[model samples]
Target: MMAGQEKGDLSLVALTKSFATFTAVHPLDLTIPQGSFFALLGPSGCGKTTTLRMIAGLEEPSGGRIHIGDTDITETRAYQRNVNTVFQSYALFPHMSVMDNVMFGLRRRGDKNAKAKAGEILELVQLGQVADKKPTQLSGGMQQRVALARALVNRPDVLLLDEPLGALDLKLRRQMQMELKRIQQEVGLTFIHVTHDQEEAMTMADSIAVMNAGRIEQLGDPATLYEQPRSTFVANFLGQSNLVRAQVNPGGTDRIVTVRVHDTDLEVSREHLPYGVDDVWLGVRPEKLRLGEAGGPNQLRGIVRDVSFSGVATQYAVEMPWGQELIVVQQNDGSARAVLGETVSVSWAAHHGFALDASQDAAAGAELVEDHG
Candidate 1:
């Protein structure tokens, strides 16, 4: 541990936040394991930021408790909490040098080894060589790293990052994502990152909690959540998914359900069904689908509407007889490309389809238009 820091898990019980008649966060329970990198991911107005702020003690909850290990800190002030936040704004003292900015927090806490500790953190973030340079002299990525070093130098039990890479360009954001993950692992502190970018959360976090409409929609590791989404919202939000309405075959075995989609039978694993229902939404990722002759158990014939070649892969939008489009992605391995207006067969493995309750909204994952007025 660095200086005054201690390793502790963070937990929230029935936490809620409201402003007048609007509730920003509903009462929910969450526990972040010690030294684990967790992410709160969602779109705007989803209460992810509010949840993070409540844990940081920057936003007081309307009800419930916040705890670090066994100690209740719900009533603790922002500065009194054993947590530090790194926001999108680097918030570095522009006039001060990188070294001075990193040491400022330590010196204020009356640590005698402030300079030594700052130097150590600077090296950890790979910014020791530019310690003498001011924030203006550094690149955006470098400034963000300096801000990270400053926060980590305090050695807070938990580090909160509020879209720290939002201001960076695409390439730089990808670079910083790996860098942040590396730094978090090296320091062994719990990191709670909040972001609207799905790729960013999936790339860096050990576990992710998908939030929406002031509640958690789903929570799991990256691969599990991506491969086996529990809801249509999660399936569409995390990545591209083709959801087709299907009905469970009447005499199917419990281990596998034969779903009828567009006059074709598709075998889906019964284990993927969350509830016992005859009506279901068969979900499959675009990459899981293949374009070929109709010889598989799950196969559909459609007219190719469009083709997009994106270097690594080719995406095809095939329009079915019912006017629904099925998106398929094929790796660019020198295979013959499908031509638009040509009829083709699309097939996927039986187990690749995930069944969700049909009662759920078919447009659950559609993007909401934000009111800017």
Candidate 2:
């Protein structure tokens, strides 16, 4: 299945799922570019896991269709589809050695070369030295490697992962994130990873689908998704954002729009906004916002109500004139963070704020359906 295959190519059309009175995922339509590291990111109960399961053929969709490259596998059973998954559980056999666990899938296919292939995959995941170790003997990270080897051993056209790093500790999770990326690049396989960690998704995925209630809120590169979310839900979900409800100022340049928030008018750049018309949410990430100097084109006066030192950076909750608490992040450059109860000016470049439309909001809410259901 190697030569002439479109690596990692997948297409989902109007995919949806419902369980009796509850809807797990809303109808979704997306085309994942071949061989791209795509992330489905959302909180718990978000349909990310369900979506991955649907792709893996573990759960049938309530509606819509699925296609893998040129093959239409909508009705195909899980085993018949050319896809494999590394679940969050690792799901390795505790009684079997690493090599045996990896070889399990191949053995079921009656491949006499299963041992050779399993050894090669174990080496690829840097677990060759522990090929004979049982699951209980290996560390969490090592066990994860075995799980990945098990998935990759089949050489599937696409690999799906569901929070594969969720079980590891913080440091180990970070380490594994890099290792997973390296392996994905090495294999040049299309990897669809489901994760709730925004930083993890941003670090690993070439593009991400930020889901809400079984629907896609935004799909774009990490920079695009973070810098220019298309709806209020997306603005608030991906990271810490100050959502200032505003309207586009009429008679401004296409790239510049004025919005009214809290009895004050704010002029923001529209270049980053995804909507055509501007009844929009001013989406600004905490880091994109700056404090201190005032009297800028896009600026706001606010009182710092609270502050917390988080080692690497300082977090401030600023009460803006609009009565909304805006979060501001200041890098810890060896200086003390801003103090609470201080009056400060918070501002960002117009380009940093984005406009969103209603459909985007609905899509964002849909990304969380599974978590809630």
- Winning model by lDDT: 1
Quote each prediction's TM-score. Answer: 0.94, 0.89
Candidate 2, 145-198: lDDT as tens digits: 899999988888889998999899899998999999999999888899999888
Task: List model 1 lDDT by residue over 1-373, tens digit each.
Answer: 2222445688889999999989999998899999999999888889999999898888999999988887788887887777888977979999999999999878877899999999999999899999999999999999999999988998888899988998998999988998989988888899999988888899999999999889899999999899889998888778878999998887678687788987888888878876668899899899888889532468899999999999999999999889999999989988668998999999887778898888998677556422110
Collision pairs in model 1: none
lDDT of 2 at 307: 87
lDDT of each: 0.87, 0.81
List the RMSD of every prediction in angstroms: 2.8, 3.6
